[model samples]
Target: MPYMGDPTVSIILPTYNRLAYLREAAASVFVQTYDDWEMIIADDGSSEETRAYLRAIADPRVTVLWLSHTGIPSIARNKAIGRARGRYLAFLDSDDQWRPAKLAVQLDALRVSPDCRWSYTAVDLIDADGHPVDRDGLAPWVPYAGDITERLLWIHAHIAIDAVIAERRLVLEAGGFDERQRFGEDYDLYIRLAMRSPVKVVDAPLAVVRAGNGENYSANRIEAYEGWVQLYQKHSATLPGKRLRAIARSRRAENLLILARLYTNAGQSWAALRTLLLGIPGSLLTYPPWAWRAAKEVVRACFKATQRRI
Candidate 1:
């Protein structure tokens, strides 16, 4: 089935004080092979320079919504979505740039897989200097198709928001982005989308994600983990079957283990021990041996420390 209508892909960009990078990002969009697109930039409390830069852009396809600094990307994103007129929607962060063929390839894939309402391409990680980082041969994503709700919830794979494009209606049906989530908001939205339909994947790397660019909205690991916990609480009840719920529990346990490690590294021994104990039951339910192994590792570390003191 051939795609119909204007074929305009609305690019939703939410930015805050990243003027230099935003210019590069917008340039990438302008150079896209698929040119029938509108770039809606939601300025979330940027400085005068940023606003002036946006105002100076002469392109008629570009639209800017100057909003008060809400400190929430989701809020900015939702505002852009409200004003979007394109049949398809794509997201690009201010600090990320796409290959010229990025939109073209994703749009082609979606056209081919008409049943798949949304799709994502693989991404290459670039350092602050914009050079590709070597990943020791690990792909950005594990390839999978069809209903990926359980797989996503279990954290077996991930879809980068910057690498994705979706039918506008489907995104709206997924409730855009959750405003309440300060971190992992994209992850929460992705889960809801996967639950609705099977997501398609474009195997090619078509986007460049700027790593460590100093505009790190997701810099707080602890708060990010807490957001994940909140997502589990929000969606676990809606998931189907005992197995899916079990996976959710295991994921929770895994996050707790991570939190405990963070605490241990920061010299909060008592808190680490308590968190580890809290995680034990769920860990045993998921993989009993892992709980035992983690306990043994903790004991060994404690024993080694005591011996050094003696």
Candidate 2:
């Protein structure tokens, strides 16, 4: 369907060299049940094949912005966002696809809740081969609505970037994605947005996310944990209320403990010890539970080291 006027939603899709997945991702948007939408594909210096594929798109509703390789998704996404011509904005990763009614359902939810400018839906996890996979060890795939600021602050609410449809102005007011953050940038944006307004939810799973892909940054355990710690600390200083600040601190401490364990498993005992020491102050300041958990992890690491020495 050709839309003459400005679209209701502008889908910001950032892509790199994943031409095959990008093809499928774009195709999903083309088949959406809702028609008043435009898709902006931001290319992050992909190979000629991917560029050629993007150029071949005949749909006028779809626009492609070519940019030099920055290797930072936030930069590419922000560029696409700058060119978006819609009241609402949605995101679809190059590796993810959406169900046919995704836009229709999310738009309906937003219409019903006039005050809610942002919405997210549950997502199904799929492997690189497009086969359904179990979400083991991942946060629960559930729908959360209304003021989710506290849940987001505590890292309890999991909102996938691909599963969101937010107002364009709200996204801009939230400062877009934090360009400095390489990992967990989406989480950072969601937290800021939730703090600004109530969120609506589409209870059904509409987005299909590709998990366990080697290209995923979250696969790097140590770096991902470090990114989480940085994210928590960044928000801790700005988020209102002493209780919220404490929650942020405690969450940061948890990530630090996890990072220490990762370092210990990699046989970097000194780094692990340093990480544990760094988390101590925050853990002590917030409450006892996290401090106790930190101490237990320290003892376990020491025990493992002693066994290796013996």
Candidate 3:
């Protein structure tokens, strides 16, 4: 199966006020080895600079869409998915750029595994200057291959947005990304997708993820963890009652640990204690050991926070 239709891929990019990196991101898409694709970048509440920059792009395959501020990434993604008309959909973050052959390689992977409805490739961690975050090694995702669902359940979180490519119909069936979700919507969508269908790995680093200090989104870890809690709650009912309950407990425990760490980082001892108290119910002995380990880290973070001047 080479490709299903006239255009094999629809690269869906959701952006906010990230004009500084938008051009590079767009340039990466235009340079793809595979030509049968369209790039749909939906801007959610951006400044005039972004609008002008988007207009400056002359490629016929690249189109810009502007909409009001939704304050949620999922909403912006939903807007892009609505206008997409390709057999396969790939998501790219605004602040991230893909490798030159990213789309081409991933699309070929899908072609080989036509039965796989969802797939992701590896990614490199880069800094604000677009340099590698680690010179000695790649991120922990490169080794991922074969049956991913069972491995994903305990192997941490979302593999990053840039590496994902899925059949358009499968994405629609999974209800798309939950626009109502404010944080971790990417994880929400990915987990649901894994539960529904098997996932394939391209086994290549297809994108560069900008990761560094003082970042706007990554700094807000507590909020992102809270959003993860909401996601599990929202989807628990969709599966068997027993599995839902188990996952819910695990998600809650994980969330509580994050809240504790956040309070510790803020140098609020009492706040950290409260956060731990919240974790107790979810961190019961019945839950996984990872939650317990996270609980200990939170405790240390709280103490370290107290040693600092307030």
Candidate 4:
């Protein structure tokens, strides 16, 4: 179906070297029940084959921008956002796909809740082969809507990047994606957006996310840790009230425990121990369950002999 008049949503797709999955991602958009949408594919210096694949796309609604290889996805997304001419902006990473009703349902939800400018849906995880991976994909807290900022600060929600759709002004107001962030860019943007306005959720899994692909940015322990630290430092001061601040501290402690696990996985037992120690004190007050689990995991892993771990 051809798009008529102006599009309601501008889909920002930033790609690196993931050519194999790019076509599938675009196909998902083409099948959307909502016809009024534009997809901007930002080619961040992919190979000639990937470039050719993008150039072959004949859809007028799909605009492809070729740029020099900039390792940051936020830069490519920013370029797309600059060129977008839509009331709402949605993100679809190169390696992810969405359900046909994703746009229509989200748009309807936002229409009913006029005050909520942003919304995200649950997600399904797929393996490298595009096969369904029945892991604990969604967050424990589901179907959360209206004023979820406090809940966001404390727990990890299943809001996938491609699953989100937000008003153009709100996204820009949140300063767009942090260009300097090599990781956790989405987390930072969503947190900031929630701080300003209430965000809603679609409740159902409307997105298919590719995880454990080995090529993903989250695989980098050091960069992931840096991103967590950056998040803590950036948002810690803005949290209102002592309770929220304590929750923020617990979140930081949780991140440290994750870092400790990463260290333990890499056979850096002493480093893991040090990281766990740093988090232990705050974990007791903010969230004891995560703290205890982290401690047990870190200790168990620290005892293992040094070996190359994935």
Candidate 5:
């Protein structure tokens, strides 16, 4: 094992079956203007293609490790961190790629602000095909502060793990990533990190996130929001009073609305109706368009129940 004592960063790229995308993502990493870095590609149980592709990379900075299939991203990420040997740990999803300047600029930001333990850059939302996304999905949270501790509780406005770079010690002290969470693990990790210290942001966007895949995690909004609600419940003890209670109420509505859809998907319309009703007021106030849609579903379910009686 070569001691990369002077390397600036270790980027963890986790892949399951994305051989072609992983190849492109790897190329992007090698092309970075900032030369001193290590890229560890943690390959979860993948097809023979990806297993073979991992063997073909020539870069000395790149190291590929294989593990059996595990659906939990947090676990795979934690495994990668265990293998990391950099002063700073950056994350780049297998399907995503970064601009050449990403490491250089983000390092400058982290260097200038010694008090901030973690920093992230903005990112471009692209399609599954790697084409630029027209929709401004993550742009809403732009120009946010270097110190963003309290603001992280409400919602996960930061979507790109590629944008984030955390000090290795800080990443370990923050407990790294949660291994148990099936959904919204990134959100939970960010909240915990923010609570301990400030999360800084670079205004410039340096990475591109693949979007528009119907199978993407965010597609199941209900489960993700429910997980968010649980995250708050689990961590509320460490937070302030009103903020804690309000987050529960706020996240509860989001969870219920998602649960309503989940119930509907499971063909439990009545259960869905109950959840929609319980979730409405809060959702109406917080998630207007989505809550509005849930309200319509509630009315539809009520009429369907009346018809069943007839």
Candidate 6:
């Protein structure tokens, strides 16, 4: 049955060419225990089959926006957000899914904590075939609550966008996602939002994230690291206190060093050298040991290349 009046929550789902995964994700939304919700699916020029499936959605509460392929999730999600009419906003990627009680639990948390404008839940990591993957080495699940801006800045919180439910106005106040960022856009938005309001947490894992899927955009390590560097540069100065600023600088330097190592491993010696040099100022100001580690990476690459010829 078609729902009447405005929904309490609006789900912003962005998709590319993953139709198989899209079906499962969309179905998860349809099966949610909470029914007074709408889903806005932003399709970034998917194939005809995907388009057909979207168009066949008979649910009046669902809206599909078609855009020319930008290959940018931020653009698609921002468009969907602009069209949202609900009081609260939720996010779900095309490859992820939510448990039936996801919305109910998060909504209850926000209701009890009237001061909080956002809430997030833990997530279960799954493989492409939907099999559970061990979270052994991944960031430990922490039930973070209240003002988490510093935690986000320090990269201590593992808040996943797909597991989040935030007030629509707060999301708009944060200016939505940065369109220029190809990756880590969610982290950037979360930091901005956390600065404005405290957040609640649903301790249970109610979201399922498809991990180690090579088809996902964030699977590209170089681009992901570059995105983090851009975020640090953009927000470092705005961070309050000298301690936070120093942490930002150190994190930026670490990302640059990681990128440098990646370039060295790929045999791009000149690029590696340039990246290492770029990180030097931050390393000197914050963590000087990273400078030596980056230098070693460059030297090791050169030595390996020489040994190969001999």
lDDT agreement with native, every candidate: 0.82, 0.89, 0.75, 0.83, 0.76, 0.89
Per the 3 Å backbone cut-off, how many clashing residue pairs does candidate 3 have?
A: 0
Candidate 2 — which residues are off by over 4 angstroms? 1-3, 135-140, 289-310
Tens digit per residue, CA lDDT, model 6, 1-310: 6688899999999999899999999999999999899999999999999999999999999999999999999999999999999999999999999999999999998999999999999999999999999978877877878988778877889988899999999999999999998888999999888888999988999999998888988888888988988888777788777877787888888888788777767777677788887777667768878867887877976776677678
Candidate 2 C-alpha error for residue 162, in Å: 0.9
Q: Rank the candidates by TM-score, best first.
A: 6, 2, 1, 5, 4, 3
* Lowest lDDT 10-residue stretch of candidate 6: 300-309
287, model 6: CA deviation in Å? 2.3
Local accuracy of candidate 5 as per-residue lDDT tens digits, 41-92: 8888889988888898777888888888886678788988998888999999
Superposed by TM-score, candidate 3 places the C-alpha of residue 20 at a distance from the truth, in angstroms, of: 2.4
TM-score of 2: 0.91
TM-score of 1: 0.85
Ten-residue stretch with the least lDDT total in model 4:
301-310
Clashes per candidate, residues 3 or more apart or on different chains: 0, 0, 0, 0, 1, 0
Report how far off residue 170 is in candidate 2 (Å). Answer: 0.4
- Report the backbone clash tally of model 2: 0
Model 2 misses residue 42 by how many Å?
A: 1.2
Clashing pairs in 4: none
lDDT of 1 by residue, 1-310 (tens): 2233454799999999888889999999999998888889999989999999999988878889999998999999999999998999999999999999999988998888888998887888887778887787664477777788887887666677899898899999999999998878987888888877788898888988987665577777777876776677566566777777777776776676676666656556566677677667556767566676678647744655566568
Task: Report residue 53 deviation for candidate 4 (angstroms).
Answer: 0.9
Q: Give the per-residue lDDT of model 3 (tens digit) for 93-124.
A: 88888998987888777778867787888788
